[model samples]
Target: MEILIMLAILSTVLGGWGGLNQTQMRKVLAYSSIAHMGWTVIIALINPNLMILSLMIYIMTTLTLFMTLNLSSTTKIKSISNLWNKSTPMTMIIFLTLLSLGGLPPLTGFMPKWLILQELIINNNPTMAIVMALSALLSLFFYMRIIYVSSLTMFPTNNNLKHHWFFTQTKTTNMI
Candidate 1:
């Protein structure tokens, strides 16, 4: 039990701090996955069922994020700054997906983390819960960075590149 708790704490800390210097979008997402998996492992020590549920939610949200990034052809942090010019709706979806991954309320991503935290407290492990929560805040910083770069910044106007006028496809057939 002590080993499991220590590993969980270590995983949480590493996950939060690992992506701070990452410029590649894929590497950032990988670190985020590691941090989320830490949460799942922590809960799994007490209850395997909840861990499975959390894993499933994490998988779904991550799939949505990666698929969106793939479709946008964004592979690096610098490229994400121009995402708003390429597809406004997809940019919005990406923002929401990032928020959800950060475990914000009213989103599917919040459910598993919330439940796991509650379980931790109920199991008389408030210290681990607090550590996990603080680590989550750290992870939120990078998630916000991705969101800000992808949706908040304006495209560079100095370039003479002709903008393509793509008809907005209401149905995201590829997403299915």
Candidate 2:
């Protein structure tokens, strides 16, 4: 149990810290997963059911975030900065998804964390619970950064293209 607790803390630190310098959305997600793993490890120790629930919520939120990036054919954070014009609704989804992944309140992502934190507290591990809560703040920072970049800030775009680079291409196949 001690080893697992140490591992959980390490995972949380590494994932949250590593994501701080990421310029690519995928890398951020990867780091976020690492941090989330730490939470799950601890949650698993206290309540296996909550672990599964957290994992499921994480999976769903991640899939949505990834799909937004994939559908936009973007990787770097800068690439997504101008996505507001391409699709307003997608930008919104990415925004909500990122928040949910960060475990923000009123979002589906917060449910597992809330329950897990409660479980940890009820189990008499207030110290570890506090650590997990602080780590969540770290995760929230990067998630908010992405949201700001993707939605709040706008990069100057060239007027030459009517659509994004990915959507501008036309592939034609001949039927034989």
Candidate with top lDDT is 2
Off by over 4 Å in 1: 156-176
Model 2 C-alpha lDDT per residue in residues 1-176, reported as the tens digit of each score: 99999999889988988998899888998999999999989888878888998898888888888888899887888877677778667777888888899989999999898898899899999998898888888999998988776665776667775754343444543321
Candidate 2 residue runs with Cα over 4 Å from true position:
156-176
Model 2, residue 69: C-alpha shift (Å):
1.3
Scanning candidate 2 in windows of ten residues, the lowest lDDT window is: 167-176
Alpha-carbon local distance difference test for all models: 0.84, 0.85
Candidate 1, 1-176: lDDT as tens digits: 78878888888789889987788988988889889878988988999999999999999998998999899998987776687676767777788888899888888888988898899999998988899999988888888877766555666554555445455456686465
User: Residue pairs in steric clash, candidate 1?
Assistant: none
* Steric collisions counted per model: 0, 0
Least well predicted 10-residue stretch by lDDT in candidate 1: 158-167
lDDT score for candidate 1 against the true structure: 0.84
Name the lDDT value of residue 154 in candidate 1.
Answer: 68
